[model samples]
Target: MKILAIESSCDETAAAVVEDGRTVLSNIVASQVEEHKLYGGVVPEIASRRHAEAIVGVVDEAVKAADCTLDDIDAIAVTYAPGLIGALLVGVNFAKGLSLATGKPLIPTHHLRSHIAANYISHKELKPPFLCLVVSGGHSHIVEVLSYTDMRVIGRTRDDAAGEAFDKAARAMGIPYPGGVELDKIAENGDDAAFPMPHPHVDGAEYDFSFSGLKTAVINLIHNKQQKGEEIPVADICASYRKAVVGCLTDNFLKAAEDLGYTTLVTAGGVSANSLLRRELERLCKGKYTLYMPEKSLCGDNGAMVGSQSYYEYLDGNIAESDLNAVATLPIDQRGF
Candidate 1:
């Protein structure tokens, strides 16, 4: 099936065309990082306005790059939930209009699910009945993929998500916005053991995570050093902070996989791009499970992943009507187009 997918979940305005779910024909992502960088974070209003401006061009470019038109597409898939409401609406409403105009079936995709589906694009042999760890800017979850359309989250963040913690910690260290990548680079030159940080392991929920405390701890450390007139080692701080975050994520994910008896592990979402997280997961899961990680480009919000999951949704008879509306807080397990 030829699926045209739209994604404007956060700072990225993206569109893509996928053939039969796995093959991405064209994935065009217009990142608003430059615009949001000045503010040291994404401003919801600015992100929404940028999405509106970029959506049409992005979709057109995706279609053109795919060497197809709307008429050639079998369906329209769009991420409608678990994102900024205003940013999401631009893509959702545009998709609705496209569906209305083309009379194609609309498929509503969960933003987080799309992140998991990103694995399919890179790893053709990766199928269901495995564990997936989704660590992104706004979410951290360990899910069991039963099938293309069937999944259950086994573990999740109790407070700030892993990627959110990374960004927040970097900002506190006076790093740039979208700080995860920058922090990762800086961390390479610093000692991971230079500064010890707390890794909160939620007691009852072994698989669950708590990063709010970790974020606060980093902030407090930075403040304390500043008050003492001690020059803080930014690289060391980033390395230590990343170590704490990655340690918790790796430990919790491994625990979930072991408890669930899953031998195949997949990691996705924006934080999947973190060098430390990837290295640690690979090192830890090497002898225990077969690990799958999405390609660097597929780590963040994108339409190809949406199209990949949308194909499964379509196969499972999950289709939406023209009047389908964008949902701001849709649950992961709630299956509906």
Candidate 2:
């Protein structure tokens, strides 16, 4: 099936055409990074406005790039939940309109679920019944991919997510917006053991995570150094912070897979693009289990992943109604608000 997917979940307005689920014929994204950079992060209002302006052009580009028209698309898929409401509405309403005009099935996709599906694009042999470590800006979860549309969260963050912690830490170090990427680059030159970091544990929940303390610790350390008229070792701090976060994430991820007897492991979402996380998983999974990771380009929000997941949703007879509305938050296990 040919699926035209639209994604305006955050600061990116993207569209793509995917065949079946694995083959992506075309992927187009319009990013608002430059505009959001001035604020050191994404501003919801600006992001929504940008999405409204770019959605049309992006979908057009995707269709043209795929060498197909609306008539050739079997379904229209869109991210409808767990994102900025206004930003999501742009894509959802546009997709609904397309489905109305083209008489195609409108598939409402969960943003986080689509992130997991990104693996299908790169690892064509990948299938369900695997463990996936999903870490992003707002969510940190260890999910069991029971099936294409059915997923269960085995573990999750109790407070700030790994990506949010990274960004906050980078901001304390004076790094610009999208701090996680910059911090990763800086961390490469420093020793991870240069500074000590906290190893937090949620008393009752073995697999659950808590990063708020770590984020506070890093920020406090930076503040103390500045107050003492001492220079901060930005690289060392980044390395240590990254090491701590990666260690925490990998510990739970591996434990879940081990406890569940899952031989196949996958990582998804924005933070899965982190060098430390990828390297650590690669080293640990070597010769023990097969590991799958999306390409760096596919790590962030995009339409291809949504399109990929849409194929499975279609197979499961999942379709959206005309009154489908965007939601600001929804669990990965839940379909809609």
Candidate 3:
């Protein structure tokens, strides 16, 4: 099935056309980083406005790149949940408009589920009934992928997510907007053991995570150094903070994978694009289980993943009505249509 998908859940406004979910015919994205950089983070109103301006051109380009028109599309898929409401509404409503004009069925896609489906584009051999670790700007979840359209969350964060922790720590260090990527880049030349950081202990829930304490510890470290008139070791701090976060993530991920007796371990989301994480996970999963990580191109929010996931929903005969609404706090399991 040929699926055209739209994604404006966050900063990027993207559209893509995919054949059978795994084969991407075209993936076009308009990144809002430069627009949001001046503010040190994404502004919802600005993001939604940008999506409105770029949505049409983005989808048009996607179709052109795919060498197909809307008539070739079997369904319209869009991200409608767990994102900025205004931003999501831009995509969802635009998709609804397109579906109405083109007479295509609408398939509502979950934000996190789309992240997991990104693996399908990169790893063609990947299948369901495996463990998946989802780490992104707003979420961190350990999911059991029972099938393309069916999944169960086994673990989640109690407070801030891993990516949020990284960004907050880097912002405190005076790094620019999208600080997590910069922090990871700076940590390369430094020693992770230069500073002391503790791993969080989640009582009663082995797979559960807590990164707020770690983020607070970094903040206090910087403030104390400033108070003492001591220069901050940015590289060393980045290394130490990253090491702590990565350590906690990997430990829990592996434990869940092992306890579940799953030999296939997959990862998704923007945070999974971290070089340290990719290397560390590979090291740990060596000789123990197979690993799947999406290409860097599919790491962040994009329409391709949505298109990929929509195929499964279409296969399951799930379609949305014209009244489908954007949900800001939708859970992965709800999957309302």
Cα lDDT, model 1, residue 145: 89
Q: What tens digits encode model 1's per-residue C-alpha lDDT throughout 27-95?
A: 999999998999999999999999999898999999999998888999999998888999988999999
Candidate 2 colliding pairs: none
TM-score of each: 0.98, 0.99, 0.99
Better of 1 and 3 by lDDT: 3
Q: 89-204 in candidate 2: lDDT tens per residue?
A: 99999999999999998999999999999999989999999999999999999999999888999899999999999999999999998999899999999889988999998898
Model 2 lDDT-worst window of ten: 328-337
Q: Where does candidate 1 stray beyond 4 Å?
A: none
- Summing lDDT over every window of 10 consecutive residues in candidate 3, give the lowest-scoring window: 328-337
| Deviating ranges (above 4 Å) for candidate 3 | none
- Model 3 clash tally, residue pairs: 0
Deviation of model 2 at 299, angstroms: 0.5
Q: Candidate 1, TM-score vs. the true structure? A: 0.98
Candidate 1's error at 169, in angstroms? 0.9
